[model samples]
Each structure stands twice: as structure tokens, then as C-alpha cells.
Target chain A: MAIIETADLRKVFRSVKRRPGVGGAIAALFSREYEEKAAVDGITMSLEAGELVGYLGPNGAGKSTTIKMLTGILVPTSGSISVADLVPHRQRLENAQNIGVVFGQRSQLYWDLPLRESFALLRSIYDVPRERFRENLDHFIEILDLDEFMDTPVRQLSLGERMRGDFAAAMLHDPKIVYLDEPTIGLDVVAKEAIREFITQLNRERGTTIILTTHDLADIERLARRVILIDDGTIIFDGPISRLREEYGTHRTLVITLADSYEDVQVEGADLESREGNVVRLRFDRRRTSAEALIRRAMERYALSDIAIVEPDIDSIVRRIYREGYTEGAIGSPS
Target chain B: MSVVFSRPRFRLEPYVEFAKVAMAKEATYRFDVFTNIASVLVRVYILRTVWVALYAHNAAPSELPLHAVITYSTIAMLMSLVMDIDQTRILRDSLHDGSIVLDFTKPMRVPLYFIANGTGEVLFHAVLMIPALALALFFVHIDVPSFGTLAVFLVSFLLGYSVGFCINFILNCTAFWTLEITAVQFIVTWITDLVGGELVPLVLFPAALQNVLVVLPFAAMFSTPLLIYVGHIPPAQYAGALGLQAFWLIALGAVSVVMWRLGARRLVSQGG
Candidate 1:
């Protein structure tokens, strides 16, 4: 059974329509005009226990809004949602006990207190059993490497250190589900890898269901097996990361270094993307022409020193999807 | 019957823990504490000189002589140390930064958490009240009431503190709609200073205005307790005065609850 479910969950934000000039502003004071935008428009999805899914979206794509609703920080304008058998907004306190949240842009640790003090406060806040809290704290400290700065004030810690602390703070309660919003944003490569590894360990070892939202596709590539892509307050695609790669990652780049200079290189199934210093880059559709077929066509036309086929990275595929949007085929059937 | 019997017990541990954290955080700012004590002492001396001059120029009222008035003003100044703080400032700030979502994710009552945190800060300041009080006593002669009056005055002071907290809390909740509340806060502070009986005793006001102002919640916060301390409100009328404070407490508490509910529903947290 799905541990979390939302049926047509929606949140509409109503704001006053601001006028342009001082005259219009004064007029607005007398008679107000309100404008409404649906931040999350009729989103419906479900996550089974122990599933790690990436909730991906562009900025203002209602990704955070949906997470907020699920975490009980926001009340939806309409529809229903249940997490761990409790309606989040309605039974918020109970739901809070079952879920943990970490927003990368924000740190929940107290600014003045040491990291250890924050954990103690959270222990009381969640009413965690002392022994269980200790065990979990120790586990997270080791995995996240928190012992070195445990006594340092949170404000003094670097962003990477603070994020590591935030992760531990969110998990010490042993929440069955965790929502990570941009958890690896603005981190060095090393710190990013550490967070990713910790996330993997948490899910695999504890069987914790996770919903991760990030603009960083690398995080998705490394940690999430399933990806749910949304844009304009609607789900455009949902499936495995590989399937996302397979369906939208159809284009391939073929690079060839010519032994003899060619005036203009052309292949039947490919377009010449660029060239410099006897090296040529060509873009082709994998479905239309295999790499061998394209290479055969290219070699027959020109004397080649070396040829290389580049598979589309998840980053470019996602960027293209975001820019040009996906076709109807891009949308996976509801699970 | 079963539902009532099976109702969950109220746990005080979390609030106590929050309070402890707040205390620890407040103590970290050692410089702020010393500066605050100095500021309070300066205000105490200035108020003393002003009151002495006014009493010398005009005949003092029988019920509220110069000494009684001085006691009222001195104690009111000290009360403002703990009472003037915007206890729910964290709420407004969190809303501004959109970090309030983190607060909502915790399995705790946000309002109670704020109250506990605010109380902890106040308790820390209450400790500072000692040295400040001692310093002020040196500058001005403040009459201490009898033991019974002092005991009743303490009870009245707690109620007044509740009244003050509710007023501050309700005002801060406006951030849910306005997002920027410095202007509202300024206006409220101005009005509170005028009628709160902190700067001047209410007994000195005109008889007609005094009757109306005494019933206002502003008076309930500072005037009621100060009046009790100075023996202006005698033991015979302690019940009525304390009852008025209690009534305002309940009334404002209910209004704050309503405001919080409405504000929370419409909260447009600044950004993620």
C-alpha cells in the first residue's frame, strides 16, 4: 500500500493586483482587485513505502508548494492528501511525527547554540525515547561526520557543515518519511557527494521513504531512482530516471577527429554541430541512425583519426525538456 | 465517554525544553545584557528627576503622593524590561524568511513554543531586574507595600504580563497578512506608551478620562499592577482589579487565537 497519497491536491494563491502609478495605487485603496494563481493545480501522486523519488521542477513550479502541503505547513485550497494514514493538514501534529523535512536554503539549527544542544532540544520537541535518540544521533554523527563540529555554534559552521547538521537534525527523530528540498544546493563537490551518500544510506538501511526536490540534476542522477517532473503546477512526467533518459535522451553527440582536413563534413542522419582544429562534432538521432551506421557514413565520407560517441547526460535531457517542454509521450501513465 | 477518557495527556517537557534553549541563547549575548541594564538605570534616574521637579512645582495628590508616584513609575520602568519585548517576534521573522515551515513541521504547538521561549527570555531579564532594581532604589525612594499587598501585587503582575504578551502576540500575527509590520508595531507602541500608565500614573489623569482609561486593556497590563504595588487600589478592591485583568486576558487570548487561525490560513510565507 502507498504510504503517501494525494488526490487532486491543489493550492491557489490569491494576491492583490498592484497598480502601476501613484494614481492607480490610490484608486486601489478605495476599490481592490484581487488576482489568483494556482501554485499547485490538481496534483495527484502516491509514494509506496521505502520509495526514493525526485520531485523535480523549475523555479516557481509549485514544487515547494506541494512539499509544504504534504508537510502540513500549507493547507491546500481543495482535494485530499494522506501520509502515514493521516491527512497532513488536518492531523498536522500526528503527521509531523511521521515525516522529516530539510530545506537546503534554510537551516533549522539554532543560530546561537552548539550542534549538540540543538539535537537535545529536538529530542524534547519530538519526545523521542532517550536511548533511541542517542542511537540515532550516534548513527547520523558517524555517517554525516558531525563529531568534529558538534560543540561549535551553528552560525560558525560553514554552509556544508551546517547542511550536514541540518540533515542530522531532521533525521534524529527516525521519521518514516523525509522531504529534502534542494538538499545539495550550493555545496562543493565533496560535500555534495557526502550528502548523497548519507541519503542513500538512510533509505537503504532504514527503509525510509524519501521525496527529494532539487534543481540539481546531478543529485537526481546520483540518489533518486524515480523522478517526477512537474512544470506550471502540473505533473508532466513520472517514471524511472533511466526511462526519462531513454525517452527524452534520444539525441546523441558524435565527435570525429579527421586525419585529413575536410572543407565541410556532412552525414545523412546527422547535423554538423561544430568544428575546430581537425576535430568535428555532429548531432544525430539514435533512433534514426545507430552510432555504427553514423560512424560508417562519416568514415566513408572523410579520413578519420578517431571517433567517439557521447550518450546524452541526464542534465542536458532535463534542461531540454524544461526549455522546450515534453510531448504527450513524455508523460508516464499514472502508477 | 470513551473519547473523553482516552484523551491524550498534555506534555510539558517540550515547552520546558524550549524554554531552556531560549535561556541559553539569551545568556550568550552577554554584551546585550550589560547594555540593557545600563539603559534601564539611565531611564530610572531621568524619570526620578522629572517626577521630583513636577511634584515640587505642584501640590501632590493625597492618594498618590510624590513617593507613591515615584514607586509606580520606577516599577513600571522595570516591568517594561520584561514586558516590552515582542515575544512572538520569531513568528513574524520566520514568516518573513519563510522558515516558519520548519516550525510547522515540528509536532509542537507553535504558539506555546513562542510563549515558552518568550517566558524564558523574560526570566533571564527578570534576573537582571535585581541589579537594576537595586541601582534604581539608590536614586529614588520607592515605598514597598505591606506583605499582603505585595503578595496580591505579584499575582496581579503575572496576570498583567499575560495581558501584555497577548497584546504583543496579536499584533505580531498581523505579519501573516501584511508581511511587513514595523509600522503597525510603531503605532501600537505609541498608543501603549500613551495609555499604558508606564510613563505617568493613571491617577493623575482627569477623573472622567481616568474612569475610561482604567477599563482599557492597556491599563490592565501596566496600570493595574503598578496601582496595586503603590497601594492605590486597596486590598478591598483587589478582587475587582484582578478580575478586570483576568477578563482582558481571556478576551485578548480568544482574539489572538482567532487572529492566529485566520492569519495562518492566509499566510503567504515570503519565499522558499
Candidate 2:
């Protein structure tokens, strides 16, 4: 059975549109307008145990909302969801007992408490036996490099240290599934890498099912095997990471360096996008011709200069979805 | 599920965690344990001066002694360390920053998490009060009467804390429905100080006011219970006052539990 599943799960919000000025504000106190926003419109997806998936989207794309529903933090406006046969937001305490969650933008540790104390508190909160608690603490302390900051209060640790601490805190309960929302939001590159590497290690070593949301493409590339892309509160694409790179319909950029500055260099099979002295930038379609073919054509035409190929990145793929619109990954893969 | 009482330090674990956090949190600020002690002492001294003037013309206090009144406010500062909670911030933060998502996914109930966190804060403040209470010993008048009175005082203080925590929790949990209520808390606290007998002993009030105050949960959470321990009330009356604090604790606790159930179902996980 799938570890997590959602069918047509939807959520909407009504925002008050109060008028401006003192008189309008007073009037709004009596009568105001409300605009409906579908934060998480009808959507469905399922995940198996031990699968590490990246849930991606632009700002306000319902990435958090979807995670909330799965984690039992949200009650959907319509449809149904089951994480381990329990409905989130209904059997909240039961649901909480079965899953673990991590929010990159927030710290779950007690701000006033020492890092070790926070762990000990979690140990009791989850009712972990002392033997098990000691074992888990030892493993977490070793893997996260927490010994240096273990005695420091949560409020005293640096953001990177706190992020590492939070990751360990979430996994303390030994739950079957884990949900992380932007677990690497504000950390430095090295810190982010550390957090990502830890998450990957958890999934591989422990077989813990993981759902992660992040804006950092490197996070998705390194950790998530499957990527779920979303835009405007709807899932635009969901498939293996390799598939996303394969179906990419956008053009690629190629830059060629001439032996010397070439004047009035007009090339065929590839358009000269930019020319600065000896270097010439070109735009071409991969489906239309291979890199070797395009380079050969350029060589015959432009004094046989050196060539460089730059494939489209994730940012442009996301931008294309916004501009041109997507059809297949709107909800998720069928069944 | 109740802790089987076999789990070692299970109950005390959260308190220990809170002490660490409180010290670290306090460390970040311009903190001197003496300054805090001085501030509390200053408040007590001013109140004592006022009471002395009022009693100069009148040699005797009503049923409540002048010494008892001083003792009441002297320990009243302990309430700040125990029950002065700000959990609405947690509820609001979870809703706003989406950390609540992480909490809801945990194996612990949401209200229990906040309660546990509050316990940590209280214990942290309790350690903080050691030196402060010691400093007040020199300038403040606190009569224990007997060692047995000290034990009774501890029991009464705990009951007061339970009621205080449960009441503040219900109010704080309401923020899940409508975001900010700092103003509401302020008004409720001021009323409790004025009429609930935190600032003045219930015995000092007129007969009609005293009756009304005792029947209400506010006094049960603050003054009447504390007075019971100081030998101000007859030992036979301990049962009735203890019953009041327990009843209110259960009542307020039930109300908070119901609100929590509703709030959890109504969870609308916002911004990522």
C-alpha cells in the first residue's frame, strides 16, 4: 500500500477586502467584501514508502498547503486524503503519532531550552523508552555533528546549527513517514548541503518515506528521486527527475569561440544570438539537430571555432510552465 | 495517554528543557538576576508603604492581617514565573510561518505540546526566582508560620498554577480562530488582579464582594488558595478551597480541550 495518498483534495480561503481610509475602515467594520482564493485546488497524488520526492512550485503555489493536508495540519474543503488509513485534521492526535514533520522556515525546538534538553523533551513527548532515547540521541548527535552545540540553548545556535538540530528533532519519534517544508530555506550553501545530505542518508539507511518542498533546484536534484512541480495552486508536472529533463521543449544556448574576432558572422542551423569580439552566442533546438551536427555546420561557416553547449535549467522550465501552460502533470500521474 | 509513572523523568523532562531554553533566551538580553530581583522588590516596597499609611489611622486590619496582605503580594510575583504564559504566539506562529505543520505531524497532541512548552518556561522562571526570592527575604515580610505551612503553601501554589495555566490556555488557544488577542489577555489579567484578589486579599473585601469573588474561579486561581496555606484560613476550610481550584482546573481544562479539538479540525495551514 502507498504510504500517503490524496484524491481530489482541495482547500479555499476567503480574504476580507476592507475598504480604504478612516470612513471606509469604519464602514468595513459593519460590511466588508470577501474574495475567494483556492489555495490548494482539487489535486491528487500518492507516494510509496521510502520514496524521496520533491514538491516544487512558485510562491503561493499551494506547496505548503498540500503538505499541510498530508501532515494533518489542514482540513480540505473537498475530497479525501489518507496517510496510513487515517484522515489528517480529523484524527489529529493519532495522525501526529504516526508521522514526523520539519519546516525549514521555523524551529520546533524550545527557544529557551538547550539543544540536548529539546531532544530529551521530544524523547518524552513521543514516549520513547530511555534505552531507545539514548540510542537515537547518540546516532543523531553523531550524524548531525551536534556535539559542539548540544549544550547551547536553541536561541543561541546559528541558523545552520538550528537547521541541523531541527532535522534531528523531527526524526526523533521513529515515525514511518516524514514531511519537510522548505527544509533548507535560509541556510548557507554548505549548511544546505549538510541538511540535504542528512535527509538523503535517512531515506537510504532507514528506508524512511520523505516528502520535501524547496525552491533550491540543487536540493531537488540531489535528494528527490521524483519531482512534483506546481504552479498557481495546481500540480503542473509529476514524474521521475530524468523525465522532466527529457520532455523539456525549450531551446538551448550554444556559445562558440573564434580563433580571432569575426565580423558580420551569420551562421546557419543556429542563429547568432550574441557576438562580442571572438565569442559568438547561438540558439538552436536539440530536437531539430544534434550538438555535433550544429557544431559541424558552425565550423564550416565560422572558420572552425571551438563550441560550447548550455542546456536549459530548471528556472526556465518553471518559467515555461507559467508562460506556455502545462497539461499532463496538472494533478498527478494517473493511478 | 497518561504516563504510567514508570517512565523516568517523563514528567520533569519538559521542565528541564524549558530551563535550558529560558537561560539561553535570557542570556541574549541585558540580564542581571539582581536587576530583576530589584524590580520585584521595588513593587513590593511601594505597596507596603501604601498599606502602612492606610493602617496608620486605623490600627487593625479587618479579617485579613496587614502581614498577610504583604505575604500575599510577596509570593504573587511567583505567578509571573509560573502561570504568566504567552502561547497565543505559538499558535499564531504555527499558522503564519507553517511550523504548526511540523508540530501537527508529530506524535504528540498540539495542545499538549504548548502545555509542555509552558511547563519549561515556568520551571526556567522558578530557578530565576531563587536569588530574587532570596533578595526579597532581606527587605520583604513573609511569614511561613510553620514548616507544615510551607508544605501547604507549596500545595496551594501548585493548585493556583494549574488553574492559571488552564485558563490562559483556553484564551491562548482561541487565537487559532481569530489571530491576535493580546489586548483581551491584558483586560482579563487586569480584572483578575483587581477583583480576583491578586493585588488585594479577598478577606479585605466587603462581605458581598468576598462571597462573589470566592464563588468565581478567579480567586481560586490566585488569592483564596494562597491565603489557605498562610494559616489565614482555618485548616477545616482547606478542603473547600482545594476543591474550588481543582474543579476550576478540570473545568477550564475541559474547555481548552474542546476548543483544541475544534481548532485542530479547523486548521487552515497558511503561508509556506
Candidate 3:
């Protein structure tokens, strides 16, 4: 059975019409008006058991809204959702036990107590058995390398340290379905790598189904086989990560080591994307012609010593999507 | 009815977990607790000094001895610790920071969580209060409660706690609709504590006012419960106090629960 399913999920929040400044404040003191804003607009998604899907979108693009609905934090204005055979908002407590959440910017750990105390508290909150709690704690502490700071107050820990502690606290209950919103946001390279590694291990070892929303493309590249790209409160694409690359991301750039100086080095079929020192970069879509073909043409024409192909990265793809889809005008596609 | 585990109830697990959270939180803010205890003590001293001068120096009527007034002041001081919720602060914080989203999703009952949170706070305050009372005992000839009086005190104390919790619940739900209504809650808390006897003895009120308070739960929440400890209200009056407390607790709890349901349905957060 599918672990999670939703049918046209939507959430509408009422915006109170408070007047501006002192005049609006006085009027609001006497009377208030409101308008309705649709936060999550008619979203429908389904995930099978044991599938780790990456949910990606810009801030306020309804990623958190969707997750909140899924976690039962906010009930939908319309439509239905079922997770683990229970309606999330209707059966919140049931979902809470089965699903764990980690908001990247927030700490779930008890800030005043030692990390161990927060773990112990969560053990009782989820009612994990004593042996199970100990087992999970040991594994988490070891994997997260928290042995040195297990006794430290959460308030005293570094952001990376605190994030690790939160990771442990969320896992103490041994929940089956995990929801991570930007879990690697604002982290050092080592910290981000550590978190990604832990997430990979948890899904592989424990069969924990994960729904991760991250700004880090490497996270998507590293762990997520499946990707769900959202924009303007709607899913624009949902397919394998590699498939996203294959479909809208086949363009690669050719960097040629110019044997000598050449001014106004422009190509018709291929664009002169960049030039630095003795090297010149030519970009062309693979569908139009392969990177090797472009490099061959450049070499035949210009005195080139060495050449290397650069694959299209997430930054370029997202920029292209935003520039074309979100803004005015479209990009020159495969043409 | 079997109260323990007849079903998969939200039970007291969250309460227990929240207790740890509160304790750990209190440990970090240990200074705040100390300052709070000092503030209560200062209020006690201010009231005690004024009343002592009124009775001992023949400045007031009825000759209610220094010890009697001191006992009244001490009881009011100790009870004040139990009544420091500041509902307005809670409501304002919840509305502003958007952390209320955390608990709104839980399968557990919302009002029950609020009550449990109050209980956690009471547990912490009760610890400091005991030592404060013990210290006051050394400096004053306060009347200690007998076995029967202590029993009445215990029952009435729980009732008082329920009353305070209900009032807080009703007041906090006001935040659902109102903008910046912390002043409203602060006023209500001050009136309840001062008028119902957290500043001085409720008996200091006019005879008519005391009679009116007898029928109200706010008085039962603070004054009536503490009177049993100070040996002012005898154990026999305990039944009447308990009866009044029961009526008010049931009435206020029911009203607050209804308000919570209505308020929650109308809750509109400004988040996407």
C-alpha cells in the first residue's frame, strides 16, 4: 500500500485587513476586516512505501504548507490526505507517532536540558520501550558523533551541534516516516555532509521513508533518486532526478585552451559563454549538437590545445526555469 | 470508568515529556525563577509591614493581631506564586512567533495540553514556595494547619488550581480574535489575584464583597484555599468552600472548553 497519498490538497488562510499606521490601528481597534489567501492551492501527490522523494521549491512557494498539511499541523481547506491508513489532520496523534518532523531552522531538543535529557523525554513522549530507546540513542549518538556533547546543554551547542542533537531527538522514537524541511540549510560543508550521510543511512538501514525539502542540490544529487519540483504552489515536474537532468538539463559547455590570442571569438551555432586568460568557453545544447561536436568544430576553426566539457548544473537549470517559467519570455530550448 | 489505558489516549505522556522540557528550561532560566520568588517575597513584606503597623499601632479597627495579619500576608504571598501565569504573555507569544503550530497538530486534546502546562509550572513554583513558607515560619508565629485542616487545604488546593486553569484557558482563547490583548489578560489576572486575595486577606474586603466572592470561583481559586492553611477559615467551613469550588470549577471548565472549540475553528494564521 502507498504510505502517503493526497487528493487535491489545499489550504486557505484569512488575512485580516488592518489599516495602515495610526489610522488603521484605531479603525482596527473598533472594527476589523479580512481577505482570504490560498497558501496551498490544489496540490495532489502520492508516495509509495519506502520511497525517499525530494520536495523542492523556493521560500513561501507552499513547500512548508504542503508539509504542514501532511503532518496534520494544518488541516486543508479542501481535499483529503491519508498517511499510514489514517487521515493526517483528522488523526494527528496517530500520524505523530508514525511520522517524525525536523524543521531545519527550529530545534526540537529541550534547550535548557542536556541533550540526553531531551532524548529521554522524547522516548517517553513517543512511549518507546526502554531497550529500544537505549538502542536508538546509542546508534544516533555514535553516527552523529555526539558522545562529546551528550551532556552539554542544547543552548550551549553550536548550530551544527544543535542540529545534530535535534536529529537525534527526532529519531529517538524510531518513527517510520520522516519529513525534513531544509534539513541542511545554513550548515557548514562538513555538517551538511554529516547530515546527508545520516539521512542516507537511516533510509537504507531502517527502511524509513523520507520526504526531504532542501535548497542544497548536492543533497538531491546524493540521496534522492526521485525529485518533485514545485513552483508557484504547484508541482512543475515529478520524476527521477536523472530524468530531470536528461529532459531539461542536457546542455553542456565546452572550455577550450586557446593556443594563442583571438579577439571577438564568436560562434553562430554555439555561444561564447565565457573567456578567461588563454581559455575560451563555448556553450551549446546537446540536442542541437553534442558537446564533442561543438568542441570538434571549435578545434578545427581555432588553434585549441585542450578542451573539457562542463555538464549543466542545478543553478543554471533553476535560473533558466525561473527566467522562462516565472518571468516574461521563454528560453531558446533545444532549438 | 477505567482511567488508565482503556484506549490509546493521549494520556499523560506529553505532560510528562513537557515536564522534562519545562524543567530543563527552568534550569537554564534559574535566575528568572529566583527573581520571581524574590518579587513575591517583596510583595509579602510590603503588605505585612502595612498591616502590622495598622493593627499593632492601633491605626486600624478589629484588632486582628500582627500574627493574624502576618499569616494572611504569607498565605497570600505563597498563593501568588501559584497564580503567576500572565495569560496575556502566553497568548501574545504564541500568536507572534508561530510556535503554536507545533501543538496544534498533535492528536492530544488542546485544552488538556494547556492544563498540563499549567501543572508543570505549578510543580516548579510549589518547590520554591515550600522553602519560602518554611523561612517565614522562623520569623513569625504563624498558625500551622492540623491534620484535618491540611486535608481540607489539599482538596481545596486542587480545586483552586482547576479554577485558575479554566480562567487562563478562557482568557488565552481571547487571543484567537483580539490583536494585542495582553493588557486585558494582565488586568484580569491582577483583579483576580488582588480582589480574590493574593495581595492581602480576602476578609479585608467589605463584608458584602466577601459574600459575593463566596459564590465565585476566583475567590475559591486563591483565598478560600489559602485560608485553610492560615487557620482563618475552620475545617467545618471546608465543606462549603469545597462545594463552591466544585460548582465554579465545573462551570468555568465547561465554558472554557466550549470557547476553545469555537476559537480553534476560527483560528486564522498569516502563513503560507
Best by the DockQ measure: 1
Candidate rank order under TM-score: 1, 3, 2
Candidate 2: residue A181 lDDT (0-100) = 86
User: Least lDDT summed over 10 consecutive residues: which range in candidate 2 chain B?
Assistant: B1-10
Off by over 4 Å in 1: A328-335, B1-9, B268-272
Q: List chain B TM-scores, each candidate.
A: 0.93, 0.85, 0.86
lDDT of 2 by residue, A138-161 (tens): 998998999999988889899999
Which predicted model would earn the best lDDT?
1
lDDT of 1 by residue, A211-293 (tens): 99998899999899999999999898888998888888888899999999778788888888889989888988877779989
Better of 2 and 3 by TM-score: 3
Residue-level error in angstroms, candidate 2, position B182: 3.2
The models' CA-based lDDT, in order, is 0.87, 0.74, 0.75
Instruction: List where candidate 2 sits over 4 angstroms from the true fold.
Output: A129-140, A259-265, A328-335, B1-45, B59-98, B120-159, B177-179, B202-214, B226-251, B268-272
Model 3 lDDT at residue B162: 77
Model 3 alpha-carbon drift over 4 Å, by segment: A18-21, A276-278, A326-335, B1-7, B20-46, B56-60, B63-66, B85-96, B104-114, B173-181, B207-216, B226-237, B262-272
Worst 10 residues of 1 chain B by lDDT: B1-10
Highest TM-score, which number?
A: 1
True contacts kept of each: 0.48, 0.51, 0.34
Candidate 1, RMSD to the unseen true structure: 3.4
Show pairs that collide, candidate 1: none
